[model samples]
Target: MGNEHLIGYARVSTQGQNLEQQRERMLALGCTRIFEEKISGAKRDRPELLRLLDHLREGDVVAVIRLDRLARSTSDLLQIAELLRAKGAGLRSEAEPWADTTSPAGRLILTVFAGIADFERSLISERTSSGRSAAKARGVKFGPKPVLTPSQIAHASVLVNWSRTLN
Candidate 1:
């Protein structure tokens, strides 16, 4: 594909799981380079994914066996897509044709998903702010209330000292 590199990323959720199938698929799809890892999807500290993202260049393509293997959330997916797009790279998922970044429809879908993620984040922020404001207005204390007031703590310390002297 015109000196473009096809970079593949394969991931498994745990040590027990294997990457054989995913790796094989990427190889079959003509991936010239690949990154493999065994890590939980919930973890945000995937070394291989970060490396792969950073390694991509213009005209490069990132491929994965499945969409879920690529990221933990829609926001994460969108962020990866944005990064790839910024570098003039594209994304492709073997199991999800709609996620192919090389196609116009696929790009449109990703844009919509990114927009939705943004909207969802804004809504969550607004709701949390409103809730905090209401709580403060009602004189609700934040964080764990002090375990013991200053007077109570002083009394406890005095009792402990008195008991130690008797012992």
Candidate 2:
């Protein structure tokens, strides 16, 4: 209702997805500027996202195509929302109109959903840890195979010695 600028943020987790749909939606919503990222949702250190956050001003609105586009985890979502609140900015998710942070009801709903997401993450972590422990007890190996074999190590040592002589 005020003279606030509407900004849009769109992201795709993989290379196969396109940002055209999100761009069109944000444009239809009268967004003046849009920031887009092509990265995994699990990655927290996205450059474009950080740039958009830094560019936000008081009374500005940040719109995203979906909640997952903004954050992959509850903690991340809460952190981003808190930052927006502190900056006097609002968040609007196109996928869930109830996620508009400008309204009291939307704030309450987002908080409840954040709690649920946190609980789900905890449960998943517990299950994963339990499974890993059981697998270890059964003598199963985890993680990627060692890249350097004994022969390769010896060859690397020889190379290192040769390089040291040149130095």
Candidate 3:
């Protein structure tokens, strides 16, 4: 393989967040092509991310400012890493400094981190579900309130029912 090109991926969750710092860092690292996204990591589908993945080829190196920038959840990160591995590509994180899946030690560290991320996600889900259940027991309503007031909704319902009967 020829000299591998450093492919940088940068993301920010909000418009207010600056991509300049990330761009500067990636440029400093000799990244010729950088993919940037301004979307929440919670979102599973991101256009730029997909594009970057598609553009990656064997012997390419995917660089990110941080693991969190690549993926918010552990499983997602692992999945991305696996994709890179399958493509004969590798992952590097600037912030972590030690996260380089190209090396044995980096792989070990990533595994440990993936486990921790999974645990954290599980705990968050459990807590959210418990909180919702507790609120329900107290007769708290979930989701959006009726768009119209109760009286207006009842009127609308009656009108619809009457119209259906007429039909």
Quality of model 3 by C-alpha lDDT: 0.90
lDDT of each: 0.91, 0.91, 0.90
Q: Which runs of model 1 end up more than 4 angstroms from their true locations?
A: 1-3, 152-167
Location of the lowest summed lDDT over 10 successive residues in candidate 1: 1-10
Clashing pairs in 2: none
What lDDT tens digits, residue by residue, belong to model 2 across residues 61-138?
A: 999889899988767888899899998999998888898998899899888978887899899999999999999999
Candidate 3 ranges beyond 4 A from true positions: 112-167
lDDT of 1 by residue, 101-140 (tens): 9889999999999888889999999999999999999999
TM-score of 1: 0.83
Count of clashes, each model: 0, 0, 0
Q: 91-135 in candidate 3: lDDT tens per residue?
A: 999888678987789889888988887898899999999999999
lDDT of 1: 0.91
Among these predictions, the greatest lDDT belongs to 1
Candidate number that wins on lDDT, 1 or 2? 1
**How would you order the candidates by TM-score, starting with the best?**
1, 2, 3
In the order shown, the candidates' Cα RMSDs to the true structure are 5.0, 6.4, 5.2
